[model samples]
Target: MTKITHFWAFFTFVAFSLGLSNCRTVKNGLDEKIYNG
Candidate 1:
């Protein structure tokens, strides 16, 4: 049970990171100066 919990946490983190990356790219594209000025 503990191992399963750890695995789920890791999976969730990875998914969250991926989602964030996608959003960041879209945001930068919309306002490149704000993010990469």
Candidate 2:
């Protein structure tokens, strides 16, 4: 049970970090588009 809980916590952390990175890239893309246009 402890192992499963640890795994779940790790998975959630990884997913949250990935989501943050994705948002950063998306925001950068939008900034570039605005500048170019």
Candidate 3:
């Protein structure tokens, strides 16, 4: 039971970090487009 809980916690952290990085990249892309146009 403890092992399963630990696995899930690590998985969630990884997913959250990935999501944040994706959002940052998307925001940067939008900023560049706005500036160029």
Best by TM-score: 2
Model 2, 7-35: lDDT tens digits are: 99999999999999999999999999999
Residue-wise lDDT of candidate 1 within 3-30, one digit each (tens)? Answer: 9999999999999999999999998788
Q: Give lDDT per model, in order.
A: 0.94, 1.00, 1.00
lDDT of 2: 1.00
Q: Estimate each model's TM-score.
A: 0.69, 0.97, 0.94
Q: 15, model 1: CA deviation in Å?
A: 0.5
In the order shown, the candidates' Cα RMSDs to the true structure are 4.0, 0.3, 0.4
Score residue 14 of candidate 1 by CA lDDT: 100
What is the number of backbone collisions in each predicted candidate, taken in the order shown? 0, 0, 0
**How well is each residue in 1-37 modelled by candidate 3, as lDDT tens digits?**
9999999999999999999999999999999999999
Q: Predictions ranked by TM-score, top down? A: 2, 3, 1
Q: Which prediction has more favorable TM-score, 2 or 3? A: 2
Candidate 2 clash total? 0
Instruction: Name model 3 segments beyond 4 Å from true.
Output: none
